[model samples]
Target: MKPATAAKKLGIYLPAAPQDFQDSEVTRAEFNQLQQNPPEWLAELRRNGPHPRPVVAQKLGISISGLARGGVTEPLTTADITTLLAEPPKWLVAERSTHAAVRKQDLIAKKLHSESPKN
Candidate 1:
């Protein structure tokens, strides 16, 4: 098999497909929350202030103990959520990965079509 055919057989592609920005939009509230509010692990690293967990619990009208036990790590404060809305982070590499996966599927389909004999 030629290099291209061999590579295709191995599910590899050169010059990967362009990333899709629209599909990469951050719609998950929890993920957005975690990115906006510094995680407890990160806050401790920066030493900027205490973990915002207590403050978030108070704002949400939930007991800190309840929030913690509920495993709701990285709960977002109102301001954090607002800021996230104002300016969200770009998941460039993630989008690229998704695009590549979709393109690979398309390539595989094309290869299969070419291989199949038609009546």
Candidate 2:
């Protein structure tokens, strides 16, 4: 499979697989290293889950759809997903705060309306 296709499976982007490396080849040193200490980046991705997709995409100033389309499927390392789970954009933070404020205001308005005499 093409590198991009592989990456999409894992929600990552790989411009091209190393030409000199055989796709099926795996060295003991690399395998041992992975077994001993998996990349922290991958661990974070697994922990965060899919909620970060939109956040990271927005922060990176890239369209969510673009990220989705560019996602890889195979060898879906945790690192790839971690990138998507990275910090959210400031716009989202502001939006969430605004939403909370509006909710609070609505609750207060409702309480006041109910307390007041209705003509």
What overall lDDT, based on C-alpha atoms, would model 1 receive against the true structure? Answer: 0.44
Q: Tens digit of lDDT per residue, candidate 2, span 6-93? A: 3344342333333432254445665456346755543454344332444445444444554544452233334544553475445544
Please report the candidate that would top TM-score against the real structure: 2
For each candidate in the order shown, give its overall lDDT on alpha carbons.
0.44, 0.47
Which 10 residues in a row give candidate 2 its minimum summed lDDT?
13-22
Q: Which residue pairs does candidate 1 place in steric collision? A: none
Error of 1 at 97 (Å): 0.2
What ranges in model 2 sit over 4 Å off?
Answer: 1-86
Top candidate on lDDT is: 2
As for model 2, its CA RMSD to the true structure in angstroms is 12.5
RMSD of 1: 22.0
Per-residue alpha-carbon lDDT of model 1 for 17-92, expressed as tens digits? Answer: 1133112433356334634684554344223222255554444444555455545566454565345436533432
Q: Which stretches of candidate 1 lie over 4 Å from their true place?
A: 1-90
